[model samples]
Target chain A: MKKHIRKTAVLSILTTVALVLSYVEAILPPIWAAVPGIKIGLPNIIIIFILYKTGLKDAITVSVIRLFLVALLFGNAMTLLYSAAGAILSIALMTLCKKINLFSMVGVSIVGGVAHNLGQILVAMAIFETSQIGYYMLVLAVTGTIAGVFVGIAASIILKRFEKIKI
Target chain B: MKNNNSQKNQKLRNDIILAVVIVFIAAAGLLLFVLTKQEGSTVAVKIDGVVTDTYPLSENREVSIKTGENDENINILTIKDGKASISEADCPDKICVETRAVSFVGETIVCLPHKIVIEITNEKTDDQIDVAV
Candidate 1:
């Protein structure tokens, strides 16, 4: 019973950390070199960490909650739909990868990242009411891979340390 | 374990293929941007559903369009002779501004929140007979 409580508390703390990281990322100046919508996706590290530590359910919960709160706080209602689409798609892809054991945390992260971009593009297309904007998808996919690999490496390090921690 | 290993390898190969395809598409887009260059088209700026200004596209120009009833200010667009680009935007993330110029058929510039869109269409002529009629 106590273990369950501890897990819940840890999940909440991790969610808070993810929220803060997302806010910080929002404030940072974007480094737009190759693509327009590309960013480092720094907040994804926390999501990856939570996925490795707790499990898929907790990770999904964290992702959905973080997305909702972040959108509300930012007051960008349109973004809420986009973020939800991306988060759900990413989590679904990561969970599938986990089930198949087709890759390590890094692999799953990469898949999630790519899926997130796909989801965002889908939303953009719907919003724009035109499919011509699909040209941007290729750029987003490449950028998503790079960001995913970075987050995956960070998740691996955190997971390793998490295994050693007693509490 | 063997099945898992093979499956993992397959997924990795798939991702690589996907990445390659994306790269090819990006390269094609870059080529297209280079190939179909045009000069000097008239651009009209609209903010929150109202026509604000019109200008000729010769060189990059940035104009600010303020959202009515809100403090939000969006860069109207950049124009360079028959080509227009979204140079900057006040909205969060500025995703629209990052979009490339509309040089091809059926291309559009959109700011969803602001309900602003600038589209490029073939000029219509009154003398042209309607084939469907």
Candidate 2:
């Protein structure tokens, strides 16, 4: 029971950290003016960390909670829809990549990042009922891969440091 | 220790392969778009997956598209000099407004928050082209 409580506490703290990171990214100026919706996906660092350190179930639970909370605090229904879709797709891909284990944490993170962007684009195409918007995916794929590398490196570093401490 | 070292090297190779594949696909898709693109003469405004209005690119006009409850959401589309753009919008993210004016076929200005899209199309008929000539 105590171990379970500790696990829950750690997950909650991680969720809060992810939420704060989302707020920080929101306050920061656009990384690139040419791409209006392009983001570094700071919260992804936490998600990747959880995926590597904890189990997939914990990672998913924390991700969902963070998504809902961030939407409530900083976004609306429309944002939630896009985010939920992206999060689901990203997590699923990350899990599959990790299961294969042919690549490192960075590889899994990259898969997650690229999948997240693809999910948003797919949702956009569905909503607009036009395949023309798929053109944006070219730009998104480049950005997503770059951002994934950054997030992956950050997560791996954190995981290494936490290896000494038992959670 | 040797096994671990080889595994790490293999993982690095795989990562490179994955990144290359993704980038290649994106580049190929972009090439396809470029090859098929043509100068468009019309802008189609789509709301909720339906084309609500169509405007000629040759004409200079401003269209205010009102949507949502009580028509609270507004996206002001401006067309001039054979290019279409969203000059103003009330959406949370003004991505559409920031997008460069589009004159080529398949170019789009999308306002996801407002469910609005401005797409360029080359739908001019032979008769219309002859008349212009």
Candidate 3:
């Protein structure tokens, strides 16, 4: 019972952290205005932390819930649709990488970020009904990889400190 | 302790391999993007999936697109110096306005809320740039 309680408490806190990071991201000015939809993906820190601490299923739960709640709070239907596709694909890729455990935290984060961009592009292609949209991701990949590094570093630091306090 | 060392070595190898792969992929994609780019001779303005106008990039002009029945959803497109960009947009994101001018074929600035698409096209032209070279 105590372990279960600890798990729930930690997950809830992680969820809140993810939610706040997302809100802060939305309010912050675009880091690169010329590139649309570019974000540092701060929420990925908590997602990665949860994945490391618990497992893939819990991490996915946290991501799906965070997406739904964020949509309700800050976005509309279109934003929701775009983010949902991105989040699902990103989580899936991260989970696969985590299962393999071949890469370090940074590499997993990079994979997640790149998958996120690819997923968003897929959604945009579907919405626009055109395949030429694939070209845009090429440009986006540069920044996405850079942002992934930032998120990976942040997650690495947090997870390290978090290890000292795991119940 | 030996097991831990091997695990660490494995992780190091994986990180190097993953980093190299991603960077290589990014470089390849960028190269393809640049190579495939063609100079656009015209800009096609589409509102709600219908082409409303095609303006020549060689011409300098400003077009105010009324995205809705009313004058509220307006996006001003500007063409100058052989490039096209959104000078103004009332959409909340202002994403269209933020995109820099595009003069390459297949480049687009889309405002999803307004259902506005500004695409650069390599339309057949009789211009000297195309004929001289």
Per-prediction TM-score, chain A only? Answer: 0.93, 0.96, 0.94
Q: Report how far residue A45 has shifted in candidate 2, in Å.
A: 1.3
Q: After superposing the true interface residues, what Cα RMSD does each candidate give?
A: 4.7, 1.4, 2.0
Report the candidate with higher TM-score, 1 versus 3.
3
Classified by CAPRI criteria, candidate 1 counts as: acceptable
Q: Write the per-residue lDDT of candidate 1 for residues A16-73, one digit (tens) a residue.
A: 9999988987778766732555766777888888777777778888888899899989
Candidate 3 chain A: 10-residue stretch with minimal lDDT: A127-136
TM-score of chain B of 1: 0.50
Query: CA RMSD for every model?
Result: 4.8, 2.8, 3.5
- Considering only N, C-alpha and C atoms within 3 Å, which residue pairs clash in candidate 3? none
Identify the runs in model 1 with alpha carbons over 4 angstroms from their true place: A33-35, A165-167, B1-80, B85-101, B123-133
Query: Best by lDDT, which number?
Result: 2
lDDT of 2 by residue, A57-106 (tens): 98999999999998999998888888898999999999999999998888
Question: What DockQ does each listed candidate score?
Answer: 0.26, 0.67, 0.48
After TM-score superposition, what is the CA distance of residue A14 in candidate 2 from its true location, in Å? 0.8
| TM-score of candidate 1 versus the correct structure, residues matched by position | 0.74
Estimate every model's Cα lDDT from 0 to 1: 0.71, 0.88, 0.85
Could you give the candidate ranking by DockQ, starting with the highest? Answer: 2, 3, 1
**lDDT (10s digit) by residue, model 2, range B56-104:** 9999999999989899999999999999989999987787888889999
Residue B108, model 3, lDDT: 90
Error at B127, model 1, angstroms = 9.6
